[model samples]
Target: MNKLIKKKIKMKKLFSLLWLLCVCLTMYAQATKLTVDCQNPGWLSNKITYGDQMTVKDLTVTGYINDTDIKFLCALIRDRALSGGRLNLENTHIVGSISILDDCMSNGWNCLNGDGHLASLYLPKSLKKISSAIGNISVDSLYFSPQKIHAVSSESFYGGDNKKYLKHLFLGENIDSIPKYSFIDCENLTSIHLGKKMHYIGEAAFYASTNLKHLNWNEFTSSLDYIGPKAFLNTQWKPDTILIGDKIENFDVSSFKYKDGCHVFLGKKVQQISNASQWWSSGIQNIFLHSKSIVPPHISIRYDELHYFTAYIPHGSLNAYKSDDHWGKMNLIEDITHVDSIRIFPTNIVLGHLGETASLSAKVYPEDASIKEVEWMSTKNDVCIITSKGTITATGYGECSVIAKSKDGGLQAICRVAVKESRPLTAITLDIHSLQLEKGEQRQLKAILTPENPDDSNVIWSRSNDNIEVSNTGIVKAKNEGKVWVYAKSTDGAIGDSCKVEVITHVKGLHIEPASLTFKKLGDSFKLRAVLDPANATDTTITWSCATTDVCNVLEDGTVTAVGEGLAVILAYSNDGHYPSTCIVKVDTSTDINIQTIDYPKETQIYNIEGKQLTKLQKGVNIVRIRKGQVRKVIIR
Candidate 1:
């Protein structure tokens, strides 16, 4: 019985051991199960070295991660092989670039022989930055579309002929600088877009990138310093153009290289050019030096199609300008146009002050080989001032002609002038002995001007504070309140005229007749009628209005029409001939006519009519007058 019991215990122990082994094997297999999620595990605690050979295809990783996880994840990819045998990172992202650096350098990454498949990468928005430790990768195109990225490190992408396979590289907005040698040997790169917020670019950042055709540098940077010598040498291209910031002061040699033709634009602030001659000898055809005060060393101008010269040389350096040997050999030079002449005239100048303002003129010319900009300068204060186009304005008292000379060499001209002073008529007046009138009376303003200059043309009349307007026909109207000052302005620059009158605002009554009327979009001629209060309608004018002048238009005489829509505000003003009274008239677009009797009689008649009319008709029978779309009546006794 004791032996049998011991046997049973041993059997149970063996069974338990077998069960444990099965569980261990199951757990190992579960962990090793490969899928798209684990393809780019970004935050593993351990990293696989470049020695690891792995490959995978079509991975999707979306989330926050740390550096260690990314390193190991990359190693795992290098150790595996994908279907049809090509390593692929379809879509992936990491908080750093170290893992990618190790994976790219694995087993002498060679895309040329197709041994390792490291070609394209897509970074999502979750990545915060790309690490500087990124060393080598055979990937041809790298796309980084994250919300932010810190930098692209030096030597991050290095390879040989396969380097040309990297045709496109996208940097995100958060990248502030491009580290030196980041894309040092990317010979196949055709376009590189630096982020807008980037302020610093390290030396040789794109050295030996021969295939790079277009580079769009940051626009707002103020201190962008590093661009190395021959940095973009031996690139295959057409006669492409290059543009640098207007504020940059220092530049490197051959920062921009082209195949057929090239040009360099020195910043406006660059005051001098010391070295950098080899770049000029390459494909560069033009050198635009935009400096207010600087001259670069002699340039070798060999290209035949280059003829445009633009430079801002200093004003006094005419003798220092000499064309280069090659530039002097050109057979044809474009003709230079002469600058405009100066002119001066008197505005409100007292006739006795002709010496202060006399007509003057001068001509300017293009500068010599130096290409200095020409400007007009005045040496004497209040004596005169000259504009670039040579328009002179007199300040004080004197006669002087404007002077002009080339900024570099050649070209000059001047205009002749004469000055004279004679006493001119300053004021004109009407000597009224006295206005003959009883109490409570008014009169229109009338006057003549004494010749101060006898040439001024704008003359206007006023009463107390209001204007008593007069016409070119000498017809005057008392348009406002109080005493009147009939002043005349001269448009031809002559003496003005003035007169005075006392106004009585408290008139018994005043009215401008024809309170309402209609017209076409053009106009209708009608007599301006005025009626005084207390049955004394006399010495009055009917002024018209459309209220808003910019809109509909109306004449000074009472004639109006519909210009736009809604309602047109017409005003009828009685000037007393002293002070005027105003009345508002509402004009409706609808047509109106009146058929009434002048006397009690009878007959039937019709006639087309125009102009002012007065008639009376019998109550039953009458002759109706009809004009353009309107009807009226005439009565017969």
Candidate 2:
């Protein structure tokens, strides 16, 4: 009798469980759905009563909504609860920055008195600057993107940790920008739908959002401008494809994070890609670069015997990319545009003077050909040299062929160049016969030659006395109050012209002669002249000093004597202002300056006194260097 009674009690409990499940299913089937225009004064107040909150499972608020309209809905929610349902405030056109929770708890009503958690809630499509109360409201998902939102407020998706329940978010239409740190450390965020209207993503906008993954960027970010550094750093993003717009010309490191095997489309205007050697882009097995550059844009990537990935570039650029220093490491394929052929303007080019230069121009078969970048090279560089832009430099008295090659199709065009020895210089004329300058002022004197096209355009500048200073380039500086004769003498012969320079002011500066010197043996000595401006100066005297006394020494009379091997700077101080004029002297351990008519190796390099490297020797002083360890100074008079 006891066993039978226990069995009856167990059966009764099982029947009660079945009844509770049926009631839940029946309530959902009978839940009320409401749609109303928020522009109506009593849109919510007329349709929803205080006790009807739980009954309304779906609520669609359309048209413009203000602060008062939101209060009406809160008044009803403060009395009831809800299940996994939706409440969509389509586009709040009237105003932006409205808060839902703030209206419900207004007038000191406790937040605890409001409804239970909501499953999904879309704030507004036209509302910008997500407020704290709206962002903090109890909702499982927060959906908001604006067609009119152009500014970023700190109280956005990154307001506070109170949005732990917020999960999936979606943005659509014209959103301007995502400011820096907008969604930092939002570990609960799962997926985001980026709209088509965003201009840029600020630095570290979504940084450290570890759990945030699966971003649904639109087919094309047409208005995208820039993506800041580390914008998506530490985010769990593993999208299948990434589409970059044309407006962005640069990408900062750590700006985006994606897994391996993702397809990337770079707009045609992109000129550079940094960190392509790093894991960020190395994992990407395929990339489509639409740059219209004939010469491939530089790519930073890991180079090995095997290619890391495949690169699809504009047509006709296959030959260019295949030989590139960076892009060649990857498998390159052509896409669309190509160049057919190239032709040189002139079949032969002739340069008369040694220093003369000429440009070789060309035109593609099709006038509208895109790949027009051509490179120029000379077959015999010893005769004449050519710059990358097709400018030919006549180095010696000989003949050579310059070839212009198109980077895209690798088509060639050749032009022969002939450099002849210049005719003898018969005479030299000055631009001005006489000129007067201030104490510290300087002037450039021009030298006109008999034969305008001379192989050696070289002139040596010299002054008659200590009244002024002149340079090798024919520049004159007034030193004394008296007149001075400035002469431009040709290196070929004694043919030259002279100009009279007169000072017309008080002494203001000092001038130095023999600016530099090379000492061959120990105890070599030379006197340096330091002339003060305006010869009428009360004190024209100067004192001499040597910075490196161990290497060389200077006498009070301005005499520089080389005692050791090295460089020494000799300075002469002016009596009035203590300003110093300097001369640099270098001593060689063992040097011979009398070598005449000797052949030189092809590896020999030459430089001017000004430290400018020369492809061929020029007039005045030349430094012939066999290597960095060996050097010889040669002077041509």
- For model 2, the stretches where C-alpha displacement exceeds 4 angstroms are 1-31, 36-47, 62-79, 91-116, 125-129, 133-135, 145-147, 151-154, 276-292, 300-309, 322-324, 329-637
TM-score of 2: 0.41
Error (Å) of candidate 2 at residue 439 is 99
Query: Per-residue lDDT for 232-277 in model 2, tens only?
Result: 7677886666777778777553577766655666755566666521
**Ten residues in a row with the worst lDDT in model 1?**
104-113
RMSD of each: 24.7, 36.9
TM-score of each: 0.37, 0.41
CA lDDT, every model vs. true structure: 0.46, 0.69
Error of 1 at 244 (Å): 6.7
- Could you say which candidate leads in TM-score? 2
